[model samples]
Target: MRDRIKTDELLSTSDLRVSTAATAWRHVEAEYVDEIDGILATLAPSGPYAYTVSPRMEEGKEIPTQRIVTTFDEIAETYQNLHRFAAVVAIRPVTQLHASWYTFVSGLGRGREKATGQESERPVIVLFPTMGSEGITGELFWGRTQRDSMPGDPADGSLASRFAVAKVHDTLLDAYRSGDVDALTDLAHAEIQAGLRDYEADTGTLAEMHTREELRRHLERFFGRYRVLGIDVVTSHYDDWFFFHELRWTVESRTGDDAGQTYRYHTAEYAELSAEGKIVAHIGHGTDRISAACPGPA
Candidate 1:
């Protein structure tokens, strides 16, 4: 029931166009385009977005040449290696979605947050999609993708509770960005549970502090490590018990062996708030983008 969005009218299938005239390609192209139009009609009709088609690429021919492909399964296989996907063909967008060509690329992946589309400071709902076993099936296989960063409808939680934690979030975010260690320390309760620093590795505790001074010491080094910075709130959720976030940010090292390095990192945080609105238990986790050398001007 949740997946079924109510729309007054379905987007016209004839409105979409594919570059290829091949019957084989048309079969799959129509399917993909229709799915997108359904999504737009319900969630973002006339919204900013893009759709692109890329043909299979070959060697020893012109720099930009399309090779013949018989089935849609080929596209699924190539999606595994992103470079190979690009090499397969150029990505262009449906002209109506975006006014400028550049915006289309940004929406596709050139510079997306890999989480929720909303900007900073908005409370996000934690929702995932569920499908039935009755849709047309195929050999299509796409490896797990963070590309579907946009969440579905909001999960179960009251807005009042979310706002309660958001107040603290705003303060913590502001303090961290401004490098105000004292203010950050004051925002937390005397006791803390620094969650796994590397959530993926699942190592030991990030930091377990019983006093504000201890948190302050940790904050000093943590906050001082970065110079120029950027933050984007991808998807977020409040499940009645805790407020959580999946986010990405840009940072340049300031002091340490890796001092000059720049990183675009993905992180998540789960915070437990007390009656007084101070963060009592905080779990922080994230990993740096090794491939993203240094974030530059956008």
Candidate 2:
């Protein structure tokens, strides 16, 4: 039988300190010590690895010690030290791994601090899966962790994927807000069709708004009546065939007569997209609730 594993499980936690060490090595050659030093500074405050040492002295001689005076100075000194030890660097990879692991551990630490209402440290290390080990790697790690711990689905979806979706949503919202009808059309999917049908029915304009032109005209008229202040996403979820969002909109009437009337509305939008991320359908629930006021006719 094939080994059964749930994809939602987090695999191995990354060591942020090790990850930082690896990052430092990757960019060590350049004058980007300031940047590398920033990475190191994130490791646990007051930890042993926080200091920088000079290159090893001659054999049987006391190793010369150099306290890293300034943050930039420390980075410069550490870079030189790394160069000197480059030949005998057996556990460099281990350093990187530890850095990566520390990242995760550090984040957990922060969460704990927040729960207890502790002051947050600057340059706090936080763990995030590297590009290579994100979705699948995290799933595997979580799966293994679950095997030893309690049972439950690990967080579904990779952080990168979720961030990508967020970007997509943001881009679409920008298009909509800017009245970039073409861009909006490009991003729309089948969900838009379903949404339009509902809108037409609810607004009692079913027969009049049939074609894309008619729909665009109607939207222009409707949206033209309001100045959108913001569109905030409330939630997003997806299954095999569809993705949807719960969105909140803040808008003020554009009509001179209703100039001061601002509204906050909730919408439930469903989207269907093409393989390239173009939206094919955009469907939703929109209810306008008065939220603010500007000077206008009652």
TM match of model 2 to true structure: 0.38
Could you say which candidate leads in lDDT? 1
Point to the candidate with the largest TM-score: 1
Displacement of residue 165 (Cα, Å) in model 1 is: 1.3
> Candidate 2, residues 2-55: lDDT per residue as tens digits?
233332222232343445445433332222232445444433332112222322
Prediction 1 TM-score vs. true? 0.42
Clashes found in each candidate (C-alpha, N, C closer than 3 A): 2, 42
lDDT of 1 at 162: 60
Alpha carbon lDDT of residue 55, candidate 1? 23
- Residue 286's lDDT within candidate 1 is 48
lDDT of 1 by residue, 1-298 (tens): 4334333122222212111112223323433443433322222112111111232234642112212112233333333333332221112222111110001110121212223433222211111101111111111111111111212225523455566667677777777667788888888766543332431222312333444576787677666666537677775654333455656777677776777877776665556566566665554434435425665643
